[model samples]
Target: MSTETKEKYEKYYVPEQSPWPIVGAIGLFLLAFGGGNFIQQTTGKYGNEGSWGWLIFLVGLSIILYMMWSWWRDTVRESMGGLYSSQMDRSFRQGMLWFITSEVMFFAAFFGGLFYARTMVMPWLGGEGNNAMTHALLWPEFIPSWPMVETPAGDTTTAMGAFGLPAINTAILLTSSWTLTIAHHALIKGNRNTLINYTVITALLGVIFLCLQAYEYYEAYHHMGLTLGSGIYGSTFFMLTGFHGLHVTIGTIFLIVLSIRCASGHFKPENHFAFEAGAWYWHFVDVVWLFLFIFVYIL
Candidate 1:
């Protein structure tokens, strides 16, 4: 190492300005606009816009995804080219920490709403607490029940059983967590082949889990007649499990990327922040699934 290189404290590399952020913002705007119109038109059936909203939504989604891929690809190239210093690495780690924290709070908001609706809103409608007048004025026949399968307006749907498909999905996720840990250990031991094999297995398990969830959704909609219109049960069920499934999808992609990078020898035993970050995210996704299994499904 050159003495001059070692002594250069002010050599922080600053990347040039990029237009990806603005592009991403435009993508988000289009998505929100199209999504709102699509939902309203589809659910209410009162709009002149039929399928154009959906097409616009897809375009926006594609744009956002392309932006993410390009931005991250450039960042990865920079890191691999050794343009990042120790300070930059710290910044990356901190950024990941804050991002994960934000995700946690996002899920917390949904769970909080779920609990409030289940515990308070339903109860108040069923003559509990000081809401007897509310019960009398609105939904006089509304019965307060945990898993309110029947709506106040007499709509009905079946509650999903916990021990059937959900149990299988839980097992699959747990196994994936184990396989990922094995891969991480193999990486630490410099066993590239084992790492790749186990990581691939983890990704496969994620795929299987998603397939099962999709089938479960089909069963709910087809045979069981459960949907967003079914009641609060369907709403919370989909809200919690649906978002978690999205996370699993993202985590599966993360694992696949890491597996490719591993095959190309992108990580070392001592310096693999990308791999560690992916592992942390996968584990967080797994933990959230566990909570959903217990509270959303079993309870």
Candidate 2:
């Protein structure tokens, strides 16, 4: 290589091959497989009567935790060692941008399915245009509806309302976003205690939100007859909110880590992309919940 190119390559910090990526992938796969099986068993799927799904899920979660600890340790060490340059900073920003973009698309697919079901599939099944004969011959009693409380097979469920727990959770998330912004501003001003305090509060708010949601789920299953198996409406409602809740859980952990790092005096006013990244992720999660509130709950 030319001397200039060789010098440029050497100037940028690139770590050696890491095992963490593969480890994380395995962890994610196991989490998905086990979680799916666990749900099936919970719902009384006969073949999984003696399944080890919950155990596998726990193992996967433990591996993921270990991977995060090790990976973050190495990255923090490298950063503290002054190995990353402006180029690396830009790379980090770009990587986060793309990651969030992919997440947007992931949720987009679910929203698309929701839209298609509501507008096209439901209408067609209810005797719209070309499917009139099919509807007449088949589901003649079926009603074109938004909530789809009754399944074609005769299972019924009550639709969750937009008020009460959902509205309270929305307020909590919005307030948490505001507090996180205040924390970011405090970090910029080098108010370490304020940063840590607000960050902890944000994480606590996330925990409360999860707790309330769990209660809501209990009410749905026991009183409202709403469940994962409760026809299309229940499935869509749970799928969207459940996935968003998982994101909130991850974002809460991210904020908690940032809080610990802030307490350790790990970031300076001018150099704190990790804090900014956590804020970005939290805001993204908050925005997704807004959409869920509008489309999945209110609508």
Candidate 3:
């Protein structure tokens, strides 16, 4: 290309081949396999042992953490080195948007299942409409309910209420979202100290939310008898909340890393896509939790 042509068109920086993608894929496979085994073992589904499952799961988790740190570190280095251009920034934003869209679809599937179970399966089993014969052959005494606490095989459990821990968690997440917004505003206004303070607070709020969720799970398993084996209700409940908790954990780590970078004098007012991406993710998480609170808990 001619010098003038080359000068007119900015070149995108293409990094060397990286090993993180395959490493991340392997880690995800291990995590999914081990997690499946662990669930089966805990529920006595296939007589599998839980210990090995836990081990593999933790190993996978560690590998994933390492992969994320290394990959993100490289990205940060590239960003700080001024290798990224406006086109690259747009690419990053688009990537994050698509990522969040995938996440939305993921949660939508779960919510769809919940809807199908409630509207179709539960009512059919309860002998509603023309399904009386089907109900007789299946679960004769099954009652159509919003929170089905009894299994067909006579396993009974309590439904979680929206008044306690769930409500508190909702408040916590909302507050964190507000704090994060403040932090973002502060960053834009060049108020570094306020930015750091609110960001830290948001991270702490996420940790607190996770801790409370853990306690809620403990209570569910122990006191309420609400377990993975407690029929479709239990399965759906745990699946929705557990996956959401995992997202919160990841978002918390995202915020924590951003905060650390902030403290290290990274991210400027004009060029801070990393911070913006993190905020976008956290806001998405908060919205998902709101839906969970409403449909899964209150309604």
Candidate 4:
């Protein structure tokens, strides 16, 4: 082997096989199964008698959380001890990039479902295609529109227009993206104070955006009477936007962690993979929100 490869193998610290991943998988399986049972119970279908699924789900969730915390703590300790070389840093960067790319594709699947439902399914239900009798027998008054004011089931809801808190959130997220870019630039310039200030500001903006989103959800649920059970429109709206909100929450936590690292002088000007990872995640969240604002809310 080459000298560099030999050195890499020498420095690598691979752990023995651990049971955490398999245990975590079992926990997730319980969570999913229990959640399904819980939903059925809520709908007045007493499929499972004692809420055993929910209890199991909660236990599984706790185990998963513990696993993640312990695993990440160990990884951070290893990273801080100078165990990671340049090749390791590159691997981490590439791994994070590909992880974000996978997230993009995940959201893209939802977007695609939305498009297919709006352009094809709704139209076909309204007798636009080969199902003329479908309209005549079922939803004669249904109109195929993007916001889907009236569903085939005769349920109606006012579309959330783009002129309210959503537009404000768009501006907030966009400006935060700019501030985070400035923070990244400051970090590269070795201005730790400026970097911390900008990162803190960006994190605050993320908090504000999350607050605004919570308010928007309240408005939709109470004032607009648009909820996850409203219809297909409501379902799509909540699914896409809810997942994006969750990603924003995660990204904010990532930035907060990076800010703490910066304050502790953990990242140098030359080697700051943790900071870069957080920044890249934040940027990815920003881009996803931009698309959501344009397609889901605005259009």
Q: Using lDDT, give the best candidate's number.
A: 3
| Cα RMSD for predicted model 2 | 2.4
- Supply the global lDDT for candidate 3: 0.94
Give one digit per residue, the lDDT tens place, for model 2 in 32-70. 888888878866646666389899899899999899889
Q: Please provide, for model 1 over 1-299, each residue's C-alpha lDDT reduced to its tens digit, 9 standing for 90 to 100.
A: 78988887655778779889999999988877887677556444465565578887888888888887888798889879989877877888999999999999989999899899988888888989888999999988787888889976787899999999999999999999999999999999999999999999999999999999999999998999788667788878887898899789889888988888888998889778898899999999999999899888888
Reference-based lDDT, residue 13, model 3: 84
User: Which candidate number has the best TM-score?
Assistant: 3
What does the lDDT read for residue 266 in candidate 4?
Answer: 81
Candidate 4 lDDT over residue span 24-114, tens digit each: 7887787678766664554343654746767876887777667766766677788788888777777888999899889989999999998
**Where is model 4 more than 4 Å wrong at Cα?**
1-10, 15-20, 23-65
Would you estimate the TM-scores of all the predictions?
Answer: 0.92, 0.94, 0.97, 0.86
* Total backbone clashes of candidate 4, pairs 3 or more residues apart or in separate chains: 0
Candidates sorted on TM-score, descending: 3, 2, 1, 4
Residue 6, candidate 2: Cα error in Å is 11
State the TM-score for model 2: 0.94
lDDT of 2 at 216: 95
How well is each residue in 1-299 modelled by candidate 3, as lDDT tens digits? 89988899977888889999999999999999889888988887677667589788988999999999999999999999999998899999999999999999999999999999999998989898999999999987777988998887898999999999999999999999999999999999999999999999999999999999999999999999999999999999999999999999999999999999889889789999999999999999999999999999988
Winner of 2 and 4 under TM-score: 2
